[model samples]
Target: MIKSMDEFTLTINGKQIETKETIGVINPATEEIVGHAPVASKNDLDLAVKAARSAFPKWASRSFEERSELILQFANAISENQKELASLLTLEQGKPLSFAEREINMAVYWLKESANHRLSTEVLEESETTYIEKHYTPLGVVGAIVPWNFPVLLAMFKIPLALLSGNTLIVKPSPYTPLTTLKIGEIASTIFPDGVYNTLSGDDALGPMITGHPGIDKVSFTGSTATGKKIMESAAKNLKRVTLELGGNDAAIILPDVSIDEVIQPIFWGMFLNSGQVCINAKRIFVHHDIYDKFVDKLIEYAKTVRVGNGLEPASQLGPVQNLVQYKKVKNLIKEAKQNGLKFAFEGEAPRSGYFIPVTIVDNPPENARVVTEEAFGPIVPLLKYQSYEEVIERANRSQYGLGGSIWGKDIELAKSIADKLETGTVWINEIGALSPTIPFGGHKQSGYGIEGSVEGLKEYTNTKIIRINKR
Candidate 1:
């Protein structure tokens, strides 16, 4: 069992590896140093990759049942220490305690659910003249780069899929919130064999090293589209398989048929959950002109009830932005929107200190405004008015991002029809930010490619091979 510590080390080849330099992890709520994390060098990354490469053959040779059982054990281990990890996660990631615990619980659930999936061999043809079958074979050494937001859950999902498909892995969590994940690595060290699962923590340099390393056969990354593009370019040098889950400026359309009383709370949370740091959070909203004013008023009423404070406090409903860089970016976007003469529908308050950005609502900002056009990974949401369903669909589809969008209305068929026309990877009618481990989730267009869940996601860690038998 790993205890909570102010100083954390890297796990490579089932051993704790210390680096020459160390970085400080910050608590977003108080702007205080939460912990110190060892920073890995290029050589350290190489050693981790080498370890994973060496462990691949033996790990891959294990039976599917054995791997599944091990994964379930891993999930149980996570559940056992859920409280401790959730506390540490809130310190670094700045989400409320409830959301942090939810993330941990979801991580355990995803691991167990993923364990239930199997990569069975498929029979393509059976006849007297010929027989054909397709098999899923493990790709050696996968490098999984997890983002700061939802680090544990994101990394947990990748673990079972990659390992169950028989690939050894190296996880590189974002430098901003690597503590809980590194702690997870500590737990993994005790269960899995040396080199089968490893974690390396460092500054920005480690990511390129993982993606470019020759020993690594695949890269599974979740982050910004800009960073995802760089990863793709780096992985291309070795022609390694890459799964990139990048940025999203998700939109939600509210039709006039919705009950203002019933839908306000769900829609408010949809936009403000995780303080709008989620990649699939509702950033842009389109409300029908008939009910736009009432919706906005009710949404403001619901927003006022939220209490933003330290995650450790029991009363805090929202926490600070995860890191300094993202905090500034979100603040700048809000300033830019105001400078452009956009009306503020409702701008809530925040404390004088810490990386806190109040939940702000922009009223009918133009299509090209920064708040509506770019991805605001914070609590700033822009609400736009649409006179017709076709107009809303056209506006929603115009953006370069096509990660996710939602339609809220009483007419299920009407909402479904509008959902079909929106250009996005996922669409929810009267629902937002709902993800299931059994469902496939990915993006389209500039948001990036590759699936992250379901059978399709499991196959991302493997290569397909066909076997054909001929009779003369």
Candidate 2:
């Protein structure tokens, strides 16, 4: 057990508030007590809101260049402290160290990219008498609720952009992965003025206080579809501006032209990265009927080589699921699928520990099976067969989730054609879960509304204002 002092607490109004009640942080790999963090009370949340509200005016009034410079500095600080941040992520969330490092790097990239995105001021010159120009202003006191999976990266997706757009933030990190966010707040204290950025860490109860609070001007949430619904309902009390990035049961379609061997590795990495805990991971695989069997056999062959163990182990390619709740959810889904007559195939002998679910593939799974329909959110892949391009597109769009999808084929035109038909916010041709800071990221339908990343993401935290002047 990795026990330490529970000195880490809420960062409200620019200072850490020491609390009497402590929440134990556990490492899933060994079920060890990694550390502890303070459980914030209602009063703590109030302080954070007041602080954000207080800082909003000065932050909103700053020039875009000034805000951009601070984001660049924060990015630099993140890169400089990469090791420490990555280690904390692994300790708290149990993803492989290398994966954690990659997430941190991505977070840095997001911060820098969001900061550098051009903020142009264009004047509309129409015959002098009636001239109108549009400019962006900050939304006051943004409330951000980030998930445990990819905690640092998700948090950066909101924090840097919100700050760059000149909004003060009252952030609530997932109770499971609050450590890194708390560390982020500590770093921001040195770079940002009081209340420009604040973090409150606690359980689900804290979410309502932050989202429902009248003081908060906007709310951004990333989590399950159910919770996202609740957040929307609560924010309605204030008619608060809200953006949600919820659940995704993304699909990947393989056409006859693509070689099985060529695409297997990329697909495996996409599905199993971060233990398949990603919102956009390939949860279902639809292969062309002609190549379906061969693809499945090759996928199993490659999955056997993967190593699963503690996150810190250099050779461990897959780590334990983030927490016991997710572990149980994955286990039950697999069991329920098997009960419904689906056959499970694995690359290696399943681990002795119940928490370490192997890289499992369900062959010829029924369309309605839990493995195929629900977001497994684990290293589980359900293989289904499709006869024609039309059938693949039809099945892919059948889900309520329109988060992400991928099409694989030798003909780029064919792939693009099918990609267009698949209902999703992001679609990759011959690839899966490929995301970059330059592109906007989000989902449609139940996957949640609104966008994140790129210049569009910065706008979510901003309000467009029209100012008119009269010429005498």
Candidate 2's TM-score reads 0.96
Give lDDT tens digits, candidate 2, residues 36-112.
Answer: 87788988888888889998899888988999898888788878888888898898998889999999999999888
Off by over 4 Å in 1: none
Please name the candidate that would achieve the greatest TM-score relative to the true structure: 1
Winning candidate number (lDDT): 1
Clashing pairs in 2: none
lDDT of candidate 1 at residue 213, scale 0 to 100:
89
All candidates: CA RMSD (Å): 0.9, 2.3
TM-score of every candidate: 0.99, 0.96
lDDT of 2: 0.84
